[model samples]
Target: MKITFLTVGKTEDAYLKEGIEKYVKRLKHYTKLELVELNELKNTKALTPEQQKAKEAEMILKKITPLDHVVLMDEKGTEYSSTRFAAYINKREISSSATLIFIIGGPYGFDSSVYQRANDKISLSRMTFSHQMVRLFFVEQLYRAYTIMKGEPYHHE
Candidate 1:
Protein backbone atom coordinates (compact mmCIF):
# COMPACT_ATOMS: atom_id res chain seq x y z
CA MET A 1 0.00 0.00 0.00
CA LYS A 2 1.15 3.53 -0.72
CA ILE A 3 1.56 6.17 2.06
CA THR A 4 0.64 9.76 1.42
CA PHE A 5 1.17 12.75 3.75
CA LEU A 6 -1.26 15.52 2.98
CA THR A 7 -0.35 18.83 4.57
CA VAL A 8 -1.82 22.30 4.25
CA GLY A 9 0.29 24.91 2.48
CA LYS A 10 3.86 24.49 1.21
CA THR A 11 7.09 23.97 3.09
CA GLU A 12 8.77 27.32 2.42
CA ASP A 13 11.87 26.81 4.51
CA ALA A 14 14.73 25.55 2.33
CA TYR A 15 16.34 23.66 5.20
CA LEU A 16 13.11 21.94 6.16
CA LYS A 17 12.41 21.05 2.55
CA GLU A 18 15.86 19.48 2.19
CA GLY A 19 15.36 17.32 5.28
CA ILE A 20 11.86 16.29 4.21
CA GLU A 21 13.18 15.34 0.76
CA LYS A 22 15.91 13.20 2.32
CA TYR A 23 13.44 11.14 4.32
CA VAL A 24 11.08 10.92 1.36
CA LYS A 25 13.87 9.31 -0.65
CA ARG A 26 14.63 6.85 2.16
CA LEU A 27 10.94 5.94 2.59
CA LYS A 28 10.55 5.36 -1.18
CA HIS A 29 12.95 2.43 -0.81
CA TYR A 30 10.52 0.71 1.57
CA THR A 31 7.09 2.00 0.49
CA LYS A 32 5.47 4.08 -2.20
CA LEU A 33 5.49 7.41 -0.30
CA GLU A 34 4.58 10.93 -1.35
CA LEU A 35 3.87 14.29 0.34
CA VAL A 36 0.88 16.24 -0.92
CA GLU A 37 0.39 19.94 -0.19
CA LEU A 38 -3.08 21.41 0.02
CA ASN A 39 -3.40 24.94 -1.20
CA GLU A 40 -3.36 27.55 1.59
CA LEU A 41 -6.62 29.39 1.90
CA LYS A 42 -6.88 32.69 0.10
CA ASN A 43 -7.53 35.81 2.22
CA THR A 44 -6.80 33.69 5.27
CA LYS A 45 -6.40 36.72 7.50
CA ALA A 46 -9.98 37.77 6.90
CA LEU A 47 -11.40 34.36 7.78
CA THR A 48 -12.34 33.33 11.30
CA PRO A 49 -10.82 30.16 12.74
CA GLU A 50 -13.96 28.18 12.03
CA GLN A 51 -14.23 29.65 8.56
CA GLN A 52 -10.59 28.85 7.92
CA LYS A 53 -11.00 25.26 9.06
CA ALA A 54 -14.16 24.90 6.99
CA LYS A 55 -12.43 26.17 3.84
CA GLU A 56 -9.33 24.08 4.47
CA ALA A 57 -11.50 21.06 5.23
CA GLU A 58 -13.21 21.44 1.90
CA MET A 59 -9.90 21.37 0.03
CA ILE A 60 -8.65 18.46 2.11
CA LEU A 61 -11.76 16.40 1.60
CA LYS A 62 -11.73 17.06 -2.11
CA LYS A 63 -8.22 15.66 -2.40
CA ILE A 64 -9.02 12.39 -0.64
CA THR A 65 -10.29 9.32 -2.49
CA PRO A 66 -13.04 6.99 -1.33
CA LEU A 67 -10.54 4.14 -1.01
CA ASP A 68 -7.98 6.05 0.99
CA HIS A 69 -7.72 5.31 4.73
CA VAL A 70 -7.66 8.86 5.99
CA VAL A 71 -5.39 9.41 9.01
CA LEU A 72 -5.01 12.77 10.60
CA MET A 73 -1.76 13.84 12.29
CA ASP A 74 -3.29 15.59 15.24
CA GLU A 75 -1.91 16.71 18.59
CA LYS A 76 -4.69 15.01 20.50
CA GLY A 77 -4.34 11.78 18.54
CA THR A 78 -3.26 8.48 19.96
CA GLU A 79 0.50 8.31 20.49
CA TYR A 80 2.40 5.24 19.33
CA SER A 81 5.81 3.74 19.89
CA SER A 82 7.96 3.15 16.80
CA THR A 83 7.36 -0.60 16.90
CA ARG A 84 3.65 -0.15 17.33
CA PHE A 85 3.56 2.24 14.41
CA ALA A 86 5.51 -0.29 12.34
CA ALA A 87 2.93 -2.91 13.17
CA TYR A 88 0.15 -0.52 12.21
CA ILE A 89 1.60 0.03 8.77
CA ASN A 90 2.31 -3.68 8.42
CA LYS A 91 -1.34 -4.39 9.15
CA ARG A 92 -2.38 -1.95 6.42
CA GLU A 93 0.04 -3.48 3.91
CA ILE A 94 -1.14 -6.97 4.71
CA SER A 95 -4.75 -5.88 4.70
CA SER A 96 -4.35 -4.65 1.06
CA SER A 97 -6.24 -1.40 1.10
CA ALA A 98 -5.48 1.65 -1.03
CA THR A 99 -3.29 4.61 -0.03
CA LEU A 100 -3.04 5.44 3.70
CA ILE A 101 -3.59 9.18 3.77
CA PHE A 102 -2.16 11.10 6.77
CA ILE A 103 -3.08 14.74 7.00
CA ILE A 104 -1.40 17.59 8.90
CA GLY A 105 -4.18 20.08 9.15
CA GLY A 106 -4.06 23.88 9.11
CA PRO A 107 -2.56 26.06 11.87
CA TYR A 108 -5.91 26.25 13.63
CA GLY A 109 -6.35 22.52 13.27
CA PHE A 110 -9.33 20.71 11.69
CA ASP A 111 -13.07 21.12 11.40
CA SER A 112 -15.81 18.67 12.35
CA SER A 113 -16.11 17.49 8.75
CA VAL A 114 -12.40 16.72 8.48
CA TYR A 115 -12.57 14.81 11.73
CA GLN A 116 -15.60 12.95 10.47
CA ARG A 117 -13.78 11.98 7.28
CA ALA A 118 -10.79 10.55 9.12
CA ASN A 119 -10.41 6.81 9.60
CA ASP A 120 -7.79 7.27 12.33
CA LYS A 121 -5.66 9.81 14.14
CA ILE A 122 -1.95 9.56 15.06
CA SER A 123 0.29 11.68 17.21
CA LEU A 124 4.02 12.02 16.66
CA SER A 125 4.54 13.51 20.09
CA ARG A 126 2.67 14.82 23.10
CA MET A 127 4.44 18.13 22.72
CA THR A 128 3.15 20.66 20.23
CA PHE A 129 5.06 21.56 17.05
CA SER A 130 4.79 23.94 14.17
CA HIS A 131 2.71 22.60 11.31
CA GLN A 132 5.64 23.01 8.89
CA MET A 133 8.03 21.13 11.19
CA VAL A 134 5.57 18.25 11.44
CA ARG A 135 6.12 17.53 7.73
CA LEU A 136 9.75 16.53 8.29
CA PHE A 137 8.97 14.78 11.58
CA PHE A 138 6.23 12.68 10.01
CA VAL A 139 8.37 11.69 7.03
CA GLU A 140 11.25 10.73 9.31
CA GLN A 141 8.85 8.66 11.39
CA LEU A 142 7.57 6.91 8.26
CA TYR A 143 11.12 5.97 7.27
CA ARG A 144 11.84 4.76 10.79
CA ALA A 145 8.66 2.70 10.87
CA TYR A 146 9.62 0.90 7.66
CA THR A 147 13.11 0.26 8.95
CA ILE A 148 11.67 -1.30 12.08
CA MET A 149 9.43 -3.48 9.92
CA LYS A 150 12.48 -4.68 7.97
CA GLY A 151 14.40 -5.58 11.18
CA GLU A 152 16.90 -2.83 10.45
CA PRO A 153 18.99 -1.07 13.15
CA TYR A 154 17.43 2.31 12.41
CA HIS A 155 14.92 1.81 15.23
CA HIS A 156 15.74 0.68 18.77
CA GLU A 157 13.53 -1.00 21.33
Candidate 2:
Protein backbone atom coordinates (compact mmCIF):
# COMPACT_ATOMS: atom_id res chain seq x y z
CA MET A 1 0.00 0.00 0.00
CA LYS A 2 1.12 3.53 -0.74
CA ILE A 3 0.95 6.19 1.99
CA THR A 4 0.64 9.77 0.74
CA PHE A 5 0.69 12.92 2.82
CA LEU A 6 -1.15 15.72 1.03
CA THR A 7 -1.09 19.20 2.48
CA VAL A 8 -2.15 22.63 1.26
CA GLY A 9 0.49 25.29 0.55
CA LYS A 10 4.18 25.28 1.34
CA THR A 11 6.02 24.91 4.61
CA GLU A 12 7.79 28.25 4.47
CA ASP A 13 9.54 28.04 7.83
CA ALA A 14 12.99 26.60 7.30
CA TYR A 15 12.97 24.87 10.70
CA LEU A 16 9.62 23.23 10.10
CA LYS A 17 10.61 22.16 6.59
CA GLU A 18 13.74 20.50 7.98
CA GLY A 19 11.77 18.51 10.54
CA ILE A 20 9.20 17.38 7.98
CA GLU A 21 11.91 16.27 5.57
CA LYS A 22 13.68 14.29 8.29
CA TYR A 23 10.60 12.22 9.03
CA VAL A 24 9.75 11.76 5.38
CA LYS A 25 13.19 10.32 4.80
CA ARG A 26 12.93 8.03 7.86
CA LEU A 27 9.53 6.74 6.71
CA LYS A 28 10.93 5.30 3.48
CA HIS A 29 12.41 2.37 5.43
CA TYR A 30 8.87 1.17 6.14
CA THR A 31 6.65 1.65 3.11
CA LYS A 32 5.97 3.51 -0.11
CA LEU A 33 5.45 7.11 1.07
CA GLU A 34 4.93 10.33 -0.87
CA LEU A 35 4.37 13.97 0.06
CA VAL A 36 2.27 16.21 -2.19
CA GLU A 37 1.64 19.92 -1.77
CA LEU A 38 -1.35 21.74 -3.24
CA ASN A 39 -0.84 25.38 -4.13
CA GLU A 40 -2.22 28.00 -1.75
CA LEU A 41 -5.15 30.02 -2.95
CA LYS A 42 -4.13 33.50 -4.13
CA ASN A 43 -5.69 36.78 -2.90
CA THR A 44 -7.62 34.93 -0.24
CA LYS A 45 -8.38 38.26 1.53
CA ALA A 46 -11.23 38.68 -0.95
CA LEU A 47 -12.74 35.27 -0.30
CA THR A 48 -14.97 34.25 2.60
CA PRO A 49 -13.89 31.31 4.76
CA GLU A 50 -16.45 29.16 2.98
CA GLN A 51 -15.26 30.26 -0.44
CA GLN A 52 -11.63 29.62 0.48
CA LYS A 53 -12.42 26.13 1.66
CA ALA A 54 -14.47 25.39 -1.47
CA LYS A 55 -11.57 26.37 -3.71
CA GLU A 56 -9.12 24.32 -1.64
CA ALA A 57 -11.45 21.37 -1.76
CA GLU A 58 -11.57 21.50 -5.54
CA MET A 59 -7.80 21.11 -5.68
CA ILE A 60 -7.76 18.42 -2.97
CA LEU A 61 -10.42 16.29 -4.59
CA LYS A 62 -8.79 16.50 -7.96
CA LYS A 63 -5.64 14.81 -6.62
CA ILE A 64 -7.49 11.90 -5.04
CA THR A 65 -8.39 8.88 -7.11
CA PRO A 66 -11.22 6.43 -6.44
CA LEU A 67 -8.67 3.84 -5.36
CA ASP A 68 -7.49 6.03 -2.50
CA HIS A 69 -8.67 5.72 1.09
CA VAL A 70 -8.84 9.38 2.07
CA VAL A 71 -8.02 10.32 5.65
CA LEU A 72 -8.09 13.86 6.94
CA MET A 73 -6.12 15.27 9.86
CA ASP A 74 -8.91 17.15 11.54
CA GLU A 75 -9.18 18.73 14.97
CA LYS A 76 -12.60 17.24 15.73
CA GLY A 77 -11.69 13.79 14.56
CA THR A 78 -11.00 10.74 16.71
CA GLU A 79 -7.77 10.64 18.72
CA TYR A 80 -5.82 7.41 19.02
CA SER A 81 -3.02 6.06 21.16
CA SER A 82 0.16 5.24 19.25
CA THR A 83 -0.35 1.49 19.54
CA ARG A 84 -3.94 1.69 18.42
CA PHE A 85 -2.98 3.88 15.49
CA ALA A 86 -0.38 1.36 14.46
CA ALA A 87 -3.01 -1.35 14.60
CA TYR A 88 -5.38 0.78 12.59
CA ILE A 89 -2.81 1.21 9.85
CA ASN A 90 -2.05 -2.50 9.96
CA LYS A 91 -5.72 -3.32 9.49
CA ARG A 92 -6.06 -0.97 6.57
CA GLU A 93 -2.90 -2.33 4.98
CA ILE A 94 -4.25 -5.86 5.17
CA SER A 95 -7.74 -4.91 4.05
CA SER A 96 -7.09 -2.90 0.95
CA SER A 97 -4.61 -2.51 -1.86
CA ALA A 98 -5.67 1.14 -2.24
CA THR A 99 -3.49 4.16 -1.69
CA LEU A 100 -3.81 5.63 1.83
CA ILE A 101 -4.14 9.36 1.31
CA PHE A 102 -3.92 11.58 4.41
CA ILE A 103 -4.62 15.29 4.13
CA ILE A 104 -3.75 18.29 6.30
CA GLY A 105 -6.07 21.10 5.29
CA GLY A 106 -5.43 24.83 5.25
CA PRO A 107 -5.87 27.41 8.04
CA TYR A 108 -9.64 27.44 7.70
CA GLY A 109 -9.88 23.65 7.46
CA PHE A 110 -11.70 21.54 4.92
CA ASP A 111 -14.93 21.94 2.96
CA SER A 112 -18.05 19.81 3.48
CA SER A 113 -17.29 17.96 0.26
CA VAL A 114 -13.83 17.04 1.57
CA TYR A 115 -15.44 15.64 4.69
CA GLN A 116 -17.94 13.69 2.61
CA ARG A 117 -15.21 12.06 0.55
CA ALA A 118 -13.04 11.04 3.51
CA ASN A 119 -12.88 7.41 4.54
CA ASP A 120 -11.76 8.45 8.04
CA LYS A 121 -10.58 11.41 10.11
CA ILE A 122 -7.94 11.48 12.85
CA SER A 123 -6.80 14.10 15.32
CA LEU A 124 -3.21 14.38 16.54
CA SER A 125 -4.22 16.33 19.60
CA ARG A 126 -7.16 18.12 21.21
CA MET A 127 -5.35 21.46 21.02
CA THR A 128 -4.86 23.24 17.71
CA PHE A 129 -1.50 23.57 15.99
CA SER A 130 -0.64 25.72 13.00
CA HIS A 131 -1.46 23.88 9.77
CA GLN A 132 2.23 23.90 8.85
CA MET A 133 3.23 22.42 12.22
CA VAL A 134 0.71 19.62 11.80
CA ARG A 135 2.54 18.35 8.74
CA LEU A 136 5.66 17.64 10.79
CA PHE A 137 3.71 16.18 13.68
CA PHE A 138 1.71 13.88 11.42
CA VAL A 139 4.76 12.54 9.65
CA GLU A 140 6.52 11.84 12.94
CA GLN A 141 3.51 9.98 14.28
CA LEU A 142 3.33 7.99 11.07
CA TYR A 143 6.97 6.95 11.57
CA ARG A 144 6.24 6.12 15.19
CA ALA A 145 3.26 4.03 14.15
CA TYR A 146 5.45 1.91 11.92
CA THR A 147 7.99 1.42 14.69
CA ILE A 148 5.25 0.32 17.06
CA MET A 149 3.99 -2.16 14.51
CA LYS A 150 7.40 -3.70 13.93
CA GLY A 151 8.28 -4.02 17.63
CA GLU A 152 11.09 -1.57 17.07
CA PRO A 153 12.65 0.55 19.81
CA TYR A 154 11.84 3.85 18.12
CA HIS A 155 8.56 4.19 20.03
CA HIS A 156 8.17 3.60 23.77
CA GLU A 157 4.94 2.49 25.37
The per-model lDDT (C-alpha) reads: 0.91, 0.93
Model 1 residue 50 lDDT score: 98
lDDT of 2 by residue, 1-157 (tens): 9998999998999999999989989989999999999999999999999999999999999999988999999999989998999999999899875799999998899999999999999999999999989898899999999999899999876
Candidate 2 residue-wise lDDT at 40 = 97
What TM-score, over all chains together, does every model reach?
Answer: 0.97, 0.98
What TM-score should be assigned to candidate 1?
Answer: 0.97
Give candidate 2 regions above 4 Å deviation. none
Candidate 1 lDDT by residue in tens digits, 1-157: 9888899999999999999999998887888987789888888888899999999999999989899999999989999988899899999999887899999999999999999999999999999999989999888888899999899998877
lDDT of 2 at 134: 89
